[model samples]
Target: MGTQFLTDEKGNKTAVLLPIKKYNKMIEQLEDLHDIKLYDEAKRDDDGTSISIDEAFKIIEEKRKAVK
Candidate 1:
């Protein structure tokens, strides 16, 4: 990953320039972290409204069929 900094006329660091690949990788990592946080929050909740894996898969398949 390569990076360069943009500076003001007063030589103060203002912004950064990163390789597109590095920027994309950073975005993916942030998204993954967000997913993990959501999962953790859901796990900590005790409202017993969860469905079984089979039932979940059935619902997903039904939705896919409806879309098609």
Candidate 2:
């Protein structure tokens, strides 16, 4: 394991310490996994309704204008 555990006076685990690079890598992997889960859920619930790229872009532009 790429971690060191911090202990309390009773020798019980309190926290953890790991290299910065390893922590960053773990965070990146977790983000990727979350994206995959979202994609899977979207795919599972997908309907036939769809739009072209230009249409989607136009809708996004309109929403941005409304936000401003």
Candidate 3:
């Protein structure tokens, strides 16, 4: 496994540690993402909330309407 520091346009930094295969997979997925934001949200426990892809889309739609 290897570790690397990644910097954003704004000079923010992130440290990622992964095996070569995992790193390549991440690179492939990141290349497909036009914009990606990484953040930490508050949670009550280590095993936090879980939602499926369909549920995520529904939540996005609900939030989008409130912004309109």
lDDT values of the candidates?
0.95, 0.94, 0.70
Query: Candidate 1: how large is its RMSD?
Result: 4.3
What does candidate 2's lDDT look like per residue over 1-68, in tens digits? 68999999999999999999999999999999999999899878879686777999999999999999
For candidate 3, lDDT tens digit of each residue in 39-67? 23223333656777799999999999999
**In model 2, where is the ten-residue run with the lowest total lDDT?**
43-52
Q: Go through the candidates in order and give the clash count of each.
A: 0, 0, 0
Off by over 4 Å in 1: 57-68
Per-residue lDDT for 48 in model 1?
90
Tens digit per residue, CA lDDT, model 1, 1-68 = 57999999999999999999999999999999999999999889948999988999999999999999
TM-scores for the candidates: 0.72, 0.71, 0.30
The 10 consecutive residues of candidate 1 with the worst lDDT sum are 43-52
Which pairs of residues collide in candidate 2?
none
Which TM-score value belongs to model 1? Answer: 0.72
The RMSD (Cα, Å) of candidate 2 is 4.3
Q: Give the C-alpha lDDT of model 2.
A: 0.94
lDDT, residue 27, model 2 = 99
